[model samples]
Target chain A: MSVSARPEVRPAERAEPAGTAPQPDTWRTRLRRDWPLLVMGLPMVITVTAFWWLPTLGNVIAFQDYNPYSGGIFGSPILGFTNFQLLFSDPQFIRAVTNTLGITAFQLVFYFPVPIALALLLNSIMSPRLRALVQGVVYLPHFFSWVLVVAIFQQMLGGAGLLAQTLRQHGYQGIDVMTNSDTFLLLVTSQTVWKDAGWGSIIFLAALSTIDPNLYEASAVDGAGRWRRMWHITLPGLRPVIVLLLILRLGDALNIGFEQFMLQRYAVGSQVSEVFDTFAYFSGLKTGDLAYGAAAGLFKGLVGLVLIVAANRVAHALGERGVYSKS
Target chain B: MSTTDTVIPAPGRGGPRRGKRGRAPWEEPGSLAGRLGKGGVIAVVLLLVIFPLYAILLTSLSDSRTVNAAGGLVLVPDGISFDAYRQIFSDTVVSRAIMVSTGVTLFGTLFSVALSVLGAYSLSRPGSFLHKPMLFSVLLMFVFFPGIIPTYLLVSSLGMKDTYLSLILPSAISAFNVVVLRAFFMNIPRELLDSARIDGAGEFRILWRIVLPLSKAVTAVVALFYAVGYWNAWFNAMLYIDDSAKWPLALILREYVVNAASLPAGTAGVAGYGHSVPPTLAIKMAIVMVAVLPALLIYPFVQRHFTKGVIIGAIKG
Candidate 1:
């Protein structure tokens, strides 16, 4: 799941005032002057248009009874909204939607604050060496592939895993947490925490370090205790960052890491594991129900676009830049 | 993370009166129960992160006898051996996958960084030809996902299926990376470029000799991001590459490790080690190590640049 961080372009006033600049160049003149720069940008433009934009345009297949063999997107007969109707009625699609939303909401509540708390804990450590060591150990997992993470968890918690073996040795029944559908939510949440919580804390820690040390000193002189200082000063300092990240997370509610669920689908079964991306992969690519799958994907994408635009407005209402600024 | 480094007071600033480590005078030391509780939490967090790594490393290195003695994943190393690594390397599937992953990461990162640097530089100059429209096109991607089916259909229709180009081309230019690079580029003093322009230094020359040398940290961080993405990627391979022989390490890793499939029968013949083979668990853990070691090795060097890189895109964005 990728959260798009949109950098607002800074004003160009530093170079020259637009009002005071020379007369506007003709299109030909500008083209002649800027051809070299445009040449630099050509490869990216072609690549993105071909790979990103063209595919985006191809989402119109959702409106057709698309059959590549008989007719491509243009030649296929259009049956607008029929695929969407079929998608909504399909129980599997509904389950996928429910599971995706459920997981997103669950993580928002349970997994979101972890990094904030971790940053706080790390900030409290007086020894820089110990802090660095802990940071290094925790951040290592963020770089590991999802497959490796799932494999590690399996060795530790699967039916024939370390935990199970240790339990059997003690005359207790072995537990297979990895394959337990009932606790799949908790299992995935824990895995996500283990993998990403440390890396997520980097931003919060940066925000924390930017907080003036003088605030804590001044608060202490006023007889504020640690908890009070944390509540009154530290949390306030982290508020802007916390709000900004929270908005981004809200915008990304539909996007979860697809590989994690894809890997575990067989273990826990798709009833609990299927998500929108996995659903699209199975229904569209796996089964060649291109129209139906595209409809499902387009529905999700449209909703995501609307949600993000709405969320950005909320960010601006709160006087933050959000992902994209006015520029 | 680099931001935390500045939190430490310089000795000269503090007049050497304050020691390297101590609670400040206004702060009360934690009570015994509290300190122990905090220490216990830290220890648990550390163990949670470290134990799995330590277990896998030990298990991968353990001999079959030691692995059998431990029942499952060997937590403690009784005997160390390279038998598992030897078996894994000897397997053509794994060796080929490693080479594939390495090649993809190297070529993909270079291609991506070069594209981003070019695009970012092109757009960094405001009032240049078509800057607004071009930037809008790039930023539009942040809000709109092209959806999977269309992308898959497009790739296959273009006859890129079962090819390495399918892996790298789709994700070659991340808009965020381009924007971040552009943001860094825009910060360069205009006078520097103007002086170069007066001396007849072309835009490329200014970018090469001036901008890049000054922006090494962000560039390295961006390159690291792309390299890691290329290394860890499997979904694209799964979607596009129907040929299992062309599978990268990550895809093979998923099939072998997560799925817990037995190695192909000829894997032993390929290794030429019919006797004294390590347990399958050791081989699995060894594969995990192989997949992870590059990331672990490369991370420390770029760790310090993370906060700087992240902040530029995040807070500024």
Candidate 2:
């Protein structure tokens, strides 16, 4: 959030060079220099304020004993800490916390390394044409709407799905993980792997291509085997990219997905499917408890903020610029 | 050099003669076994991605019986028919959804891109009026996410319920898009903009004539990103617009195609899968195809801009 800035030249004026440029000795001069840019920014200011900043203020409802029958925020009884207290006391909220953490952890472990592996493999391919073809096919899923992804999955593995029916024709009972709520976690995680891993590998692939190829040649001349060369040179080259994406992932860890869970919530039931986002939506709409939902959402947002800062600090400690630098 | 570990006979290997047929120093893993291993992994991944997509196309075009037999996906393409697509288009509910989605994507992308361009151009120059605060505010959004409940309440309270504005206005600007566009804008030579200023050209004129002309690639990329975003977004529609008729194609796909239990009541009789020419699954697959089609078409054209997009996006937060 830190800003390093130089003054902009207003269109109305002929601006001089940086060293000799006019600095406003008075507020009027500053205003004269600045107002046009402000005018240009007006639409965006309203857009951000109304959509993001204003709604952020609505989180104050979390501290109220909110009832929709009453007027909004001020009209509701002010119950300090009660809504949050109720949220923590509820068993459903606890399950949602677990589900959110569980999904994020599963993705961090199983889904995180997939892109790196794909990038390495892509980098190793001998023929450029074949490599491009593979890259094309793999990244296609990244653009799909999650609903479409869920639909395709359902069509594939639901009880009446293609494979399931094929198995039935052979007199074998078919497996339908789409309907099997017990394995829903694994199914969803695999969907994430299928949908995103290849697309995610792009940054790493770009990073890999930028590595000085002569280093590998030099290492080979030193009689270092392919394995040793990879571990020493290639991995080190990919480290900065990997760390950047990893830090970004930590900031987004709690986002352990909403649309996927929302689409599939009916199949597995809310208990298993409810993450922080779906929890907010379901409680607010389905349960008719806006205040409680806001409380849960606020709690998640605050925790996410804290975790991102902490993760960035750790990344800084590890010598990678995490997202952005303090300077 | 080290045991010649690979069975691969490097086609371009420079034997003892370094000058005659010297290989680039960087090329490695020229082993036959290694090549086979890498090829095998890539082939499997290719299938993993392609298989379902192939099945979807086949299922959408397959005659109803084959589609039914396979449950919903076809193993082979045969007796291809456009009946599913025809049926979907003929149905007003689905057709309207498509229209709504198209309208939203077009209008939303246009408005969003316009706003983002103006904002990015203004912010690209450092120390622009309120630049620090504006940029800092956007960066903070990455941390302090406004939640769904609050957002939903705000929109509903604003009387935007069931209106298309709810879908478009809330997502009018993406900070990432602004940052990327700003990066591109700033990369335009300062001397060029300065010369424009010296020529008595106004800020807007310079942006439109000089700056924008040079930034066509990034502008196209950012525009496509917004279009794709507006097209794919259904969550806002779901939360704000309860009228199914006003639903975007993505939401309709979610409801009728994906959610078997919640298909529109009039379309199906007792079976719920709807006994029809293009079977339920075929129609569902058709819906999925239509939902994914525009992106599939546009992505390859803009694919070259992706590396630039991602790198520029990363340059900020």
Candidate 3:
């Protein structure tokens, strides 16, 4: 069961009883009571207005033939869905879409279970100190930037890196794991695992530790082997977290990240490396085609929104606490 | 289990007894072979994770002469040289970048914490005006990320381009951090607040005297999260800052280490330093270390609070 941390606030319940609610004096008293709280909220209100709301309003350009020469949103000519139509018609955009989904799918297949495996392995070790040390070591790479991670992989396995040098010394051929277009999926996914698997296991380990010890003890007394105990008790205990994270992951299927690809795109060539974020950056920001780029972004945002909401509903239907409760 | 079952407990009773080496009480005492096997797995995973660190350190320290001899990456440490650490510290470009990064992280974290703490506090009270709308707005940002182009346009148009504020403000407050902080704030017992209110304590007084002090652990965790974020930021610099001299350490490290490119001219000492400089390999690895090392040093201290606070606040909040 999830521990409730948020004050389950219901705005409707907080409203005053209907009828006989019209007085300047009443609002004044309410304002007097709430003005201090509102002061605390001032920075957030300003920030959200400037950053979130304004940028959201800037999405208007996506529907317009926006020009830098023109004064932004108001001055731009309307071109409803024209930019989106052009975006979809481009072969490069199609390539980006395919690459995005392809890499995301590969990560889901290969990288998703890594943390679960890690958490289970870690839980099996009875020594708390050992578990902590291993955890510290493995969780470390998560803090490293994607640039550093890609660099680390290149340093170890690139054409002129340690493995390649050692192979050359032993009279073998060069290694090109870092720059090879064919193995891009494997290399990137491994980097993802190396960077995130340990960190991801934190929640799973938290979940694992929460399982009642008596369950394990009872199962063991019932003549279950270690593997059988794990399959029956441990696995069941982790199901909620697994489902929760899976739903979240499905929601984020489009966000495969950008830095790794951007850093490596030169080495592997853009042919195999272009994803939506990079494509958006290249097409919009770098080339000064804000409207077209915004269209691509808007499309991605729409899909992501639908995906997350649907995924949350599915999680609720399956009796899992996905991200938020429906209330 | 390894105590030879000498206590001779009744059937169900023995399942909860002490076992050797702190094995689970219900576990069959692992055989010597089994323990060794477990240790071996841990060892291998540790080696795999740590091997890159060793390689980078060794390469950074290896005497410039022996580095090429030892195959691109220095596999073994031989006659450790401080040339790399010395060079980057001495170099103007890298050192300035380090200063820039420190400034951004310190200021950025402070700004982020202030905004998030205030916002979270404002949203924590259930019946406050605009509480639900504000909270839902924040939550909606998570589902529908503002597109990169529009965000860039907004920041640029607002005259944040090339400014340090650009580094700090565009991504100033994280939704996750806000949610976590709000969760922590909300968890403060309602009765405690009510009692404080009855004692004539205003919301601000209660927040400062009671809430802030009580929530130190979560506060530190959120602060560190923002600090690390600011330190690791390069994409913002790439997008907003045009002046090469304004580049932060992460951006510099990205250029020198990841892209394997030399710093552009006018950056610092690199342009004028003709020939006698140390090996580029050592310099690159040293930058990598510089980028990564601070987090390592600071991690252990914040780790306890970080794990506990983030798990409870983030997942549950």
Candidate 4:
């Protein structure tokens, strides 16, 4: 409930007077003073710069006629928006964009409330032991690889799976939800809920913990029933957290689990399951169209950045602490 | 089961009945109605979470003959056998894949954690020349940047194709881990660093000697995350590694579970070891279990650390 006990500020550390500027010192002395932290930071700086940042710069190939074998990213001739033009011309790329947006929208609407519901249900339980057991069980799926999760689902619900097999044994038709395109969206959303809902509830539970116990006591005294109290107090208390999480989810809407979709792509025949990342992976890497793939990826990244910033702005406007302090 | 029965509990009232001497309505003792309601909730939760695991485990343990003959649900194996596991382990290909997976996970975690800790500690400091920009870049990496294709091209063009580095380097330092470690490092008193400085302790020395020891919980958590990420990593392996021998256990498991018809000869050695039993659906399940077993084993030890790590990582990042 308290998040944590207020971090203790030892007296010796507090000895420095407030509102006083640090003493001017020699550059050597200043370097010596900050050197430990700086040195500690060097490995990360070098690693990220070389691996993440430099490779990121390679995305510039999107604007060039880059051929991996013939010339490197820097050596490639500039082609302006040719890659974008190529991407626009591809019907598959258009389908990818549409599918990605559709999946993102589905997850946002259908999958968003699951964690909240789970948290509330878990919160309602009085037995800590039972609550914990349930929590652990539900969270186990999150650790599983998307491949395993999909396989598990297929083994249980596919046409030849346990459920369908049982139906056939009883002289009924076997339902094939796994490879059915019409049910693909529902299938993916359900899988997402199964895999992440419990883990997602951790934040909501943290929010629940912050609700004042005395408020519940007062509500009880007023004879407000469980449903009414949930409506008035619990939901309102969770408003900030829900809004914050929603904003975060909005920021990650484009990222809809690449491996999960990719694994099932063959089964569903790509018509229903080709999202942006998988689309890019197949187009760029599989097809050797490096520039085109880079362009698509860069496009997704820009959209994500804009969404995050816009969400943060909206959160700030709504008078809530966003994911980051604007400073 | 019915819509009306799932009445939303009042938030502030806690539940339908409360303060009944350690008995909430959800768990109200001695009342049939209350007991039934509580049992129903527990049953539903259990069904939703536990049943699939049970079903999978049962199917995985069942012999292929029994599985085929049953023609439907096999809640319990007719006879339990270790043939599946034996088949997977005995096979040279599967064994080699496991070795590759283990190697990647071990090296990847070591490199990632080492880099992340150092970076985080540096970033945690109050001021440094490149601090703001570095921090912003790291955060930006978390939110957006070059997509997977560009990253794949980068790896491929750098001549890392079909090499172990493809798996390790691409995701070496997670931005989330950096943020978590930074939060933990910042929590360390500056006075400690000052005193260490006064005592002629070098920055690296202080970090290794003092900061790391105090930050065990977070370090362990971050290490676990890195390890799990590496262990479960298959996308990179699928994309970059063209050679079958270089496939990690997860990638192999993917082949086993998704494309079981083409059970590679690698898993056949273990099958031979287990009394000439062929790798079947059970073995595929065993491979899945093997792939997931390490994380499951490591998680309980670091469970407490995980919650703390996430809170710190989320709020700080």
User: DockQ for model 2?
Assistant: 0.33
Scored on chain A only, each candidate's TM-score is: 0.92, 0.91, 0.90, 0.91
lDDT, model 3, position A12:
26
Listed in order, the DockQ scores are 0.45, 0.33, 0.32, 0.32
Model 3 ranges with Cα > 4 A deviation: A1-27, B1-21, B31-33, B264-276, B307-317
Q: After superposition, how far is residue A74 of candidate 2 from its true place, in Å?
A: 2.2
Candidate 1 lDDT over B88-199, as tens digits, reads: 8988989999999999999999999999999989988777788777777777777888889999999999899999999999999888888778877877897787767766
The residue-by-residue lDDT of candidate 2 on A151-270, one tens digit each, is 888877877776787898899998888867789889999999888887887767766766776677788888888789889998998887677677768777788768999998888888
Candidate 1: segments with Cα more than 4 A from true spot: A1-22, B1-22, B269-275, B307-317
Residue A86, candidate 1: C-alpha displacement in angstroms = 0.8
Candidate topping lDDT = 1
State the lDDT at B43 in candidate 3: 92
Best by DockQ: 1
**Which candidate model has the greater TM-score, 1 or 4?**
1
DockQ of candidate 4?
0.32
Please, what is the TM-score per model? 0.92, 0.90, 0.90, 0.88
Q: Residue B72 of model 3: what lDDT?
A: 81
Chain B TM-score of candidate number 3: 0.86
Which of the CAPRI classes, incorrect, acceptable, medium or high, describes model 3? acceptable
